[model samples]
Target: MSTLLSLNAQSRDADHMLEQALQQWGGERDLWIFGYGSLIWRPDFDFSERCSAHVHGWHRALKMWSTINRGTPQCPGLVFGMLSGGSCQGMVFRIPRDYGEAVMRKLWLREMPNAVYDPRWLPCKTLQGPVQALAFTLSRQSPHHTGELEPDEYRRIFSQARGIYGTTLDYAQATFDELQRLGIADKALQRLLSYADCDRSVESVAI
Candidate 1:
């Protein structure tokens, strides 16, 4: 159908654009990528080194609505969005200079399919020093971006939403667990996990 063809065309165009971004952002040395969410647990790429880094002015929150990976149109599940304020502690991935372009392109394909994130080579503070790392932060202007959501809305989505990737609870729980392992505590995620626990219990009784 025309829609399918359009999607394919968009993918191709995105690939081409990201290929260009790689060249521009990679710089003369190794490239660093900052990850705070799924990237922390599943960075499916080969990185030369990983460092615990911190970035100010952005904190991860469940502010993005997913219609595919974690939810559907009727009950969109929530996902992390790096919002402006506070600081975040997460892992930074370093890609070899020669492999920068290829890795950037792959990352773009994975994260930018929906164009919901604002990708930039941001400067992060790491123990080694400072590095300009590629980061995907939420864009407030995007339709998928929800600057804020009610507590009950989160409970509803985590309980009812399921997508191709898995259950919303699973996604939230995994992220919370990974953060704990990394010595980073996310209070908001912890609350979501508790809500998910309640949801599972309620489902159990119904079944």
Candidate 2:
């Protein structure tokens, strides 16, 4: 199938999900979204305020298979997902109440094209205070969740997997760079990038 068609087919019931979230939110205050990965650097939507935030019970992990954005079906790439356990430090964006629905629609289109994430209202702590923010988390049982992979397999996918956006290596690098710029430390991600970089260097020498 064509890329556009495939993306459309993979989309979840976004409108319904939005409605559910809205009902649960009660239109009481601004909408906050906790971004852990690409959203940290590439939040395509406008926001009223942004802050460094922390959320408990979920940690950033390169555990989700990307079939369309970062790789193909035959060579799936890994993307960052919020998995159960520990905590995560990231950015939280607040959308004004008037723009909440519109911003949410855009977010769903970008992040929820596939039904891999379980959207949840997570409590996040920022310097200003604590706020409940929307976060996309993955369940261990989900098919897209890659619990672990052999080193060779991981390197192969990282080096070779490319999708409509770009290579998985580039995506990982971008995330790592952004986190560093924000003074956030993620040793696991740094190690993964080191390995990928070494592999690429070896390939260049061989070539």
Candidate 3:
């Protein structure tokens, strides 16, 4: 992981980060973005097409604690991670070359606007072969970045946390649904959900 991964604080400069990205990926025509989180199911991009891609050294983990979404400010919520360790199978979207910059900008604005994410480029093995794609990692600088949390705490927030987006339950439901539909039931994700406080409801509703 690069130092950028350590930039999980809430005070990053969005414009500057975008400019750096533009420079890094400048002149690229068709763009492939690897999505392992909410993007796996709910892609907010207008893409020309999508294909499967495999990225190594990272798998989804519920390593992040958020006070604003799944959990309250005091209790906080938990979110998944593309943490380094194993490989992740996810979809890669092909965005138009001319619109790549704009589309990338939209992605950054949606995810990295707070500067809490360290966006980086990684090589994704796509149908076409290996291709570089944009991905975001949590910053170590973030006060909210918890390397580990108690199982009970993980469950309480996961069981009750909600946000402007929705409840933590909704998040789990969405991810489980998407992964199962894709026939990619990631074991790590299942284990994370297993730590949640609500089982009866999750057992019936988890897809």
Best-matching candidate per TM-score:
2
* Local accuracy of candidate 2 as per-residue lDDT tens digits, 1-207: 001111243235666666666776666689999999999999999998999999888899998999889999999998999988988999999999988878887898898776567788888999999988988888788899988877787789887999999989989999999999999999989888877878989989999
In candidate 2, position 129 carries an lDDT of 96
lDDT rank order: 2, 1, 3
Q: Report the error of model 2 at residue 34, Å.
A: 0.2
| TM-score, model 3 to reference | 0.85
Worst 10 contiguous positions by lDDT, candidate 1: 1-10
Provide the TM-score for each candidate, comma-separated.
0.86, 0.91, 0.85
RMSD values, in order shown: 6.4, 6.2, 3.9
For candidate 3, give the lDDT: 0.73
Q: Can you tell me which runs of candidate 3 are displaced by over 4 Å?
A: 1-11, 201-207
Residue-by-residue lDDT tens digits, candidate 1, 1-207: 000112234433655546546656645788888998889998979999998998887878778888888888987887777876788888899999888877877887788886667666666898899887777777576688876667777778876888889877788788888889888888867876777677778889999
- Candidate 1 vs. true structure, TM-score: 0.86
Off by over 4 Å in 2: 1-12
Compose the digit string of candidate 3's lDDT tens values, residues 101-171: 98888888777756666677778887678878887766444665787767776677676787767777678
Task: Give every collision pair in model 3.
Answer: 6-140, 7-139, 8-139, 66-77, 70-161, 71-76, 71-77
Q: 1 or 3, which is superior by lDDT?
A: 1
Cα-based lDDT for every prediction? 0.77, 0.85, 0.73
**Of the candidates numbered 1 and 2, which has the greater TM-score value?**
2
Highest lDDT among the candidates is held by which one? 2
